[model samples]
Target: MTIQNSHNTLPLDPAQPERQARDEGQGPMPPQAPTPTQPLAQPTPQAQVVPQPIAYQPQPAAAPSNGVALTAMILGIVGAVAGFWAVVPITGYFSAAFGFPLAVAAVICGHIGRARSKRVGGVGRIQALVGFLLGYVSIAVMVIASAAWTVFLFIGSL
Candidate 1:
């Protein structure tokens, strides 16, 4: 087979029969006539795809992490426990020393946690408040114990 370009005279490969037919100004080849030996297969009509409107599904809001509140609560508990030990005489000094920092930390964490809870939602608000109260109570206990110890020491020394 040979193909002649309208612009120039050039022979095209027989392998590209579609290109040759197109160059010759002919459209795609028609379906072949089925032989008697091979029955003609009817073209099955395809189902037309109708796009349905997607239903709007609102996803549930994820819970925010309240680790700060949790930390505050834990620190408050531990600090309160240490402060309780401040009831003792000499040992109370060491207990107060150990617990004061913990109490302070608990108070700070509680305030931070409470603010965050208010800002983000009321998830850990209770815990934060509890921690704040516990920390103050612990500090009070330590202060009272230290004063008592100081007076007792001063009187004994005189």
Candidate 2:
């Protein structure tokens, strides 16, 4: 019927006298005797602990969009074109300067790309093969040009 001034208990409606008001840290107190002046004995209240929720985080993406074989293909094409020019009469030195290293890199990248593609079930087998072929052709051209230059020098010295 009235608010408990001392215990900070919840307010009660006079219509529901049977309902008991629970304290912040105390459990239900036994009902008081018919005499309103007497106090009832109360049991010790148990403290309930609520567990906190853990935070969720997401990881970064792993796979690349375009294939490595595509890169090998382009490098092989450029290197082969450069090395082909080195086989010419006057452009050997100039082309070799850039072509030799590029051709070697192309060959290495092509093989690595092919192996990686195979492992990942990639659809760049043909591209890798073409790139590997171009790299081999470039290296062969460079070798031939070098051998011919050496032979010409040997013959001219005589």
Candidate 3:
């Protein structure tokens, strides 16, 4: 059997030389003239569409009822007033117990109030903070007085 070269590829057109000779004899074809088309007119400037002003409707303010800030303020005032009775050991003991819970309640109320105020875009954040702080201070004073009484009693027994 005769050996054939695997790398040798066949040309697509065997008459390539004849085609090239014919193309060389004939020069490139001239471009055709464009056809006469209807001319387009410039568009007229459109009238400026002025937007009418919308009537301003005022939104109603949020009601103070059912607000945590109001609740916190009320509770804090009550706690602070009750803290005065903390001068007496027994009263202080009772006040501490009640005051601590009230203070915690005030704090929670204040936090909720502040968040709600931010959401509704109100203006009572400072009042809420004050209420919470006062409530905590009242509770602390009551607790301190109660502890002192307890220590005094312990010393007296010894």
Candidate 4:
């Protein structure tokens, strides 16, 4: 048997002249040259290389966006301001008409924002809650003012 080390090949048994001759770039010695006491070298089996499959690693999901919460907050603020202005005598009628729709839209956006925030580990949760409250408050104020105006008109007509 022979061991291959880098570019050099070494024989397991140094006493074998045929292995030494073969390792040193010389062809194997003649069959008659081999002595009876020394055994001949058997051919070594070649090793086959097998490729391994790569492991699969799961990636983390991306964080949710805060834009919805910000939009909800802005819409709620505008709707609330409109609702307050809806109490005016003349312009109130127009404000009431516009404010109610804005408040409803604010409420819808706030609900979506809050749900998204919850999924994103509480990011923008406070803004979503604030918008939700403001939307409800605006709706309530507009409703009350509109009902009072209607009642006053009804009584005046009677």
Candidate 5:
């Protein structure tokens, strides 16, 4: 018997799936070439569509409201207006005298509003200032009128 070389392996057959090499570490499988009988694919140029921008309309933003400043200003104005009767002589000093404390409360609220405005946004600084001014004017008017009335009574008694 003739000696055959063991290292000389027989060529692998395509019909045998198990006999094919495992393609160790070689990247991807190469694309198959088209046969003479099969026609190559052709890429056709079609239309290019351009995207249209959307029409988006947004509403305007509203200014934030400060409740403390508004309340202070309202109280100050009311006290200033109601203090008119308190400036009178006899009965004015009785019932309308309560406006003095309201004025004081307005001043306190105005100070609180100012502090809050500094700490957090949206509190009205102008409204707080106006409230403070109104409170001060109301208190001044009450003091001066009361003093004048007392002086008038003293003079009348003499």
Candidate 6:
């Protein structure tokens, strides 16, 4: 077969007669006629959607107590004040005696404070312990000095 070429058109391949026919404004080839051959297949089944229920959970909250902290602070202050008084000269002995009780109270208050603070949150454990220690030490020294004074007086009288 021979290829035809126009002045403004490119040459077409003779081997592609079907393409050349369509390019020349010919309609596309008619669809092939169907034949009664086999039976049609059926569609497959789809899955069903279902909703799920969620379980509810309760949470426990933290409970804080401020009383212990307040008591601790007050006791610590009292211990410090008493301990300070005990450090003086004549009044020192009486102060130390008074400070002993205050120190004991401070220690108890400090323990309570630490427990409450752990539950709530506060500061002053160091101060409470120090006050308690100082008060107790002063009380011990006072007792020893008093005993020594008594013994000395008795010996001097003899």
What is the number of backbone collisions in each predicted candidate, taken in the order shown?
A: 0, 0, 0, 0, 0, 0
Question: How accurate locally is residue 27 in candidate 5, as Cα lDDT from 0 to 100?
Answer: 49
| TM-score of every candidate | 0.61, 0.54, 0.55, 0.58, 0.55, 0.39
For 1-158, candidate 2 gives per-residue lDDT tens digits of 56666767554663334444343435555654545555666768988788989788687877643366777788789888888887777787578667877777777777888788777667677777777788889889988887787688789899
lDDT per residue as tens, model 1, 21-132 = 6778897655455647777788899999999999999999888877788888999999999998998987899999999999999999999999999887798999999998
lDDT of 5 by residue, 10-101 (tens): 43543222223334444454445665677988978888898999899888888566667777898799878866666777855652587788
Return the lDDT, model 3, position 109.
Answer: 83
Q: Model 3, 62-128: lDDT tens per residue?
A: 6654368878887787887777567686667777677777777887787787777786567677667
lDDT of 5: 0.73
Candidate 6, 9-92: lDDT as tens digits: 443543354566688888565533333464445668778777788788777875545565566556656665765665455676
Worst 10 residues of 4 by lDDT: 29-38
Error of 5 at 70 (Å): 1.4
In model 2, the Cα lDDT at residue 69 comes to 76
Candidate 5 stretches greater than 4 Å from native: 1-64
Model 1's alpha-carbon lDDT is 0.87
Comparing 3 and 6 on lDDT, the stronger one: 3
Tens-digit lDDT track of model 4 for 83-156: 98878866777887888888888888889999999888888888888887889999999888888888888899
Indicate the TM-score of model 2: 0.54
Leading candidate by TM-score: 1
